[model samples]
Target: MTSRPLRVMECAAGTPGFGAQTGLMAEQNKNIETWRRRLTFRSWHRGTKELDLLFGPFADARLADYDAPALAQYEDLLMAPDPDVYGWIVGFEPPDPAYDTLVLRDVIAFQRTRHA
Candidate 1:
């Protein structure tokens, strides 16, 4: 006998399996929100107050708009040593080529706008 094609059902709200999908989506959103909050806290609490001032406002104004790749880039920026990152932002030193990214440029631009 010939094999039959498999059919998949799309689950919309109020339909069977929809609640489970909704619950999973809600859980994923909650986890992302928590991660964002933690990043915001880190941005605001970097050891130096100057770094805090630099990152805190950028995180506050832009963090929520980041999708997964942007979030990953921001997280990577956060993981870099503070002095180096600050130096890059203020043009005292060039950012390591590997770490030079749109996210960093955005932060530098944000800082410029804030102080301009």
Candidate 2:
């Protein structure tokens, strides 16, 4: 299946949309599934336990629904140093504002919010 840019309806982040966006995403299930598989592998095997824990679970819970812009943001995040990502996740350091995006914020929230 070919990927087109994700055309999410303009809803407030995390708010439920008017059904149009959800319907559109339902149509892209194949592409989203493909991305989810690749991201799951990468997230789980990031070469560092801290990062693996932080990202793997978040990816498991969220990757399947990520739109194109969110995926692009996540790809940008994957390029950061693991140590920096770990520091941000653990609260030892804040993420560099340049790389601190909404996607990253959502990941951090997921990490902190999920219970074992």
Candidate 3:
């Protein structure tokens, strides 16, 4: 961990350049343990119990492996209304095109296995 590397990381983190995603890179660079703790809390406390179950285990299992984009997707999912997300997981509705990613697809599969 040299100053040069730290400086480079800082520069990259500062360069997201957007209205919504400005901190995306810096957030991804945060300590994994901290992120896991926060994400776990969020997953377990969703307004609906069904969503809590669906996302809690899923986040616990996958949080360590998630890249920035995957985390962003999860955050976006959290921001969405729970009923719509439930419908997506249960296949009554498709995930929004923007949220259709491997992370979400895996959760959908997990939901099927749990129900089936």
Q: Which candidate number maximizes TM-score?
A: 1
Candidate 1 lDDT at 103 equals: 92
Tell me the lDDT of model 2 at 41: 89
lDDT by residue (17-45, candidate 2, tens digit) is: 56544655676876767877887889999
For candidate 1, lDDT tens digit of each residue in 70-101? 88889999999988998999999999988899
TM-score of 3: 0.68
TM-scores of all candidate predictions against the true structure: 0.80, 0.70, 0.68
Instruction: Please report the candidate that would top lDDT against the real structure.
Output: 1
- The models' CA-based lDDT, in order, is 0.87, 0.81, 0.77
State candidate 1's TM-score. 0.80
- Give the local distance difference test score of model 2: 0.81
Please write out the lDDT profile of model 3 over residues 1-116, one tens digit for every residue: 55544544555564565234336545656655576678779999998898999999888877878866677777787778888889988889888887777777988987777778
| Candidate 1 whole-model C-alpha lDDT, 0 to 1 | 0.87
- Model 2 RMSD in Å is 9.2
**Worst ten in a row by lDDT for model 3:** 17-26
Q: Which stretches of model 3 miss by more than 4 angstroms? A: 1-30
In model 1, what are the clashing residue pairs, if there are any?
none
Give the higher-lDDT candidate: 1 or 3.
1
